[model samples]
Target: MNGGDPPFAQRIAQVSESHTTRIFTRAQQMRARGRDIISLAVGEPDFDTPAPILHATARALADGRTRYGPVAGEPGLRERLAAGFEGFSADRILVTNGAKQALFSLFQVLCDSGDEVILPRPCWVSFTEQIQLAGARPVLVDTDAGFQLDPDRIAKAVTPRTRAILINSPNNPTGAVYGADALAAVAAIAAEQRVWLIADEAYHVFTYGDRPHVPVLGLSPAPDGVITVRSFSKQFNMTGFRIGYVAAAPSVIQALTRLQSHTTGNVCTFAQYGALAALEMDPALIDRRRVALRRRRDLALGLARALFTCAGAQGAFYIFADVSAHLRAGQSSADLALRLLDAAGVAVVPGEAFHGPGHIRISYGCDSATLGRAFARIKEGIKEGL
Candidate 1:
């Protein structure tokens, strides 16, 4: 070892860089270089935060709401979150910096070395990485054609060392929403196996078609060991604010709260007030965003289906398209993504990062004009074999 080098944790060295963030960084560099890059890589809405929420934050600032507060978040926000969770009590909710932090804390508190956490493939890239950070191995089960979680596959993956299963409905990369029947089946397997079921419902507010977002806690004969994670980032376009919450059994909530207290303390005071106002304000604001997202999703899916093989994008703001048809015989997803960026100036994330190689995730959160330009560039690139 070099004398000048400080020793770092073995775990930190082993952790992989986030694929999504890496691509985002490249896009930023391209923009700096004056490239006409139409970035469809990151999952973020292009719209400004709702006006009412903005106004509320201003009011909070005027009222001197800036100070260190409860480690579990402001009481008013927790109360509103508790009410939102059907019949759950306020004590069961613990707010954190974001759903990402809440998830990291949950894994830290629950997972131990050599334990296994089951995650469905084509998942959010962070899922596997976070479990690894907690010293737990991620057991990935491949989904069916539309990226729907197959309960039978989950059952097969479970072993005596399995500690928990992480499920993300209205999922990140695939935008696949598990049906009620599928969720119920998963709950049954978790109960029979006696493993924790952690559900990520970040995109609960954005859905298309007639199906509603079903929280696993609401399942009949509810799975006794269920934990739900919710976020204000997607719902209220509060991504920069980094505010989210976890709802679970009081025991699990306490463990997560303690872990967060030592790690991030509480989220920013002003952000907490902003989220509270989002919940208390007119529901119509959220409804409008939902409708707009649905329109964008439909358009993107239409384009994807005409150009590539894609499905399971009935929710969220992303479309995971199978680009194997476009890839040359020996080419990989990373190769194809770079080529697309260079030749077409369109930025997309390779599905390889999400354990779904031969595909790429495209976000439709941008305005119609930007999406149109991106698709056109992609179309030309594919035609020219670029």
Candidate 2:
């Protein structure tokens, strides 16, 4: 075995690099080299972890609560999670390292070689990759102008091999929050087609409209094959803590728990306590953050529309603007992103990585001043063709 040789699994070799992560890495590298970069690339909150949660974590650390726990999660945390979902119980929950890991484990357990999972385009970058990593095919369905999942498109994409339909509400990249009617249509399709409906509700707590965030599980005559994945990372500003969970049928939860036991046994003990604390703490703090994010969303959308001719944001902390209006002949989103970084010191993820070319995702999770500066640079960069 030569050191320079690629020793390996063919499956691993076939995997492609994650576009968002690559862009984020490049931005970090440029910043390290002393570039004055204002990054709107990553989909994370720019706020500090809420004070109560921080204090709770500190207390847990001082209480000598650090030890290996259940593979599913700390028993009490799992109970709390189950209770959080209105009609679910502990049997329906399986907590894992992060929502990412929990989702990976779910895909591993549910999908097999040649299985098909229907994905909505302009999706989170990881969805397709995760399906491929599970030896499954991702069947992408394109959304409308607002990026809402079209039931007709999803229905057309279904086939014998189609085992599941994965949806992200308050979606990443595009902030289209699926409404009740659209969700009902999807649930109907999944039920009729006998496919799993996996809803990623990581942004569940961050809705800015008249309609509340509706989970698939909450639908009446609930699709028997629905699974809801939730994360504390975004809601509680606990991304570093790496704690998330899934709620589904008892059998599905059991399978995921078994898979977790053989793989990463459990999330960090203290993190579980921290998450529990988040659930028990003042719900008002989360509401406050929601309002703040809504304000950011509105500001970013206004700036995005002023700069580009395409769609503006509706929900989530991101505004996915079509940069095609500004594209030069043969220029890719990568080129535009690099030019923006070099000329205006602002960083954003190109849409090609999200399977939609000629666009970019701008995160508005930072403070108002930082967001103002970032958008001003973006405006200048676009006008100057940088």
Candidate 3:
């Protein structure tokens, strides 16, 4: 407090401002000033919410399906979500506002004060923050050169206080998908150590190449303590609907449900209908969308590689480029990111936000024309010593 009174909860102070939202807000302010900026920093898919989902939600509202519903999620939506994961049924699914909430709840359910959660480096920024929010320490393990998991490193990080090992396949920023062997190795370690294997499959639908996205729970010698989280945001372009679900052991699901009852309560009751519609969507839409993302990935990667030696991205819609050579004196990745946003009218994320300095993240969720223009500006900016 300003005077000699108590201040806000010190716990919240432990949370850092989200650098991605900070950059996003700045880009928005610049746009309000009439700048024709091309934003390559946003994480959401650029596609509008699909028609079937929108129609289903509209029908839901029209049919008066809008009261408070079950805290664990409506049975229909939970049943549909549960069907996708092996060994899970409706009783084992707890739908939350988004995958983000599901993750936060998982940490709360599993972690205690001073407990540790091992997260791979250059992982999603929220994972660390959420672990802290649950009064736990996050032990970050650096990945191998390709941004893939180093199971050996993760294995070494475990201690008696370790509560979970969190992995995001097709990892954010770097876009490297961990193969089946890598996942199985990690699961084995979790099982042997009796630690929870937290699998984030938010980008499961966006994996590229012949190797498909594998759910860690399905791998051989499956751990009884696996917790898998997925969302409708990326796959169905339902960002605003705020619907996602978690599949875990029935006991874990019950704990999440009880915690959620006193916490966020049920996700918007009618929004569940939209999620229901998404599960039944034509499989081809996903295929076509992935093909389009592959094209953008190729286009953006080619441009980024010309200036910096960036390897090909395997999945997700981001290209992480090492820009160490382009930095002026004393400039961190965040500095270069803001500099380009100001000078080139283009927006990209700084790698330091992802615990990676000397690198920048470019989201290619926009159309080809926007990507072409943004890259052209970037090239010109580099030529001008920006």
CA RMSD per model (angstroms): 1.3, 1.5, 1.3
Model 3 C-alpha lDDT per residue in residues 157-180, reported as the tens digit of each score: 999999999989777888888888
Candidate 2 residue runs with Cα over 4 Å from true position: 220-222, 310-312
lDDT of 1 by residue, 217-303 (tens): 777355449999999998888999999899988899889878888888888988888899899878987788888988888888888
Q: Is candidate 1 or candidate 2 better by TM-score?
A: 1
Better of 1 and 2 by lDDT: 1
Off by over 4 Å in 3: 1-6
For model 2, residues 97-185, the per-residue Cα lDDT tens digits are: 88899788888999999999999888888888889899999998999887877999999999999999998987888877888888888
The C-alpha TM-scores of every prediction are 0.97, 0.97, 0.97
lDDT of 1: 0.88
Off-target runs (Cα >4 Å) in candidate 1 are: 1-4, 220-224
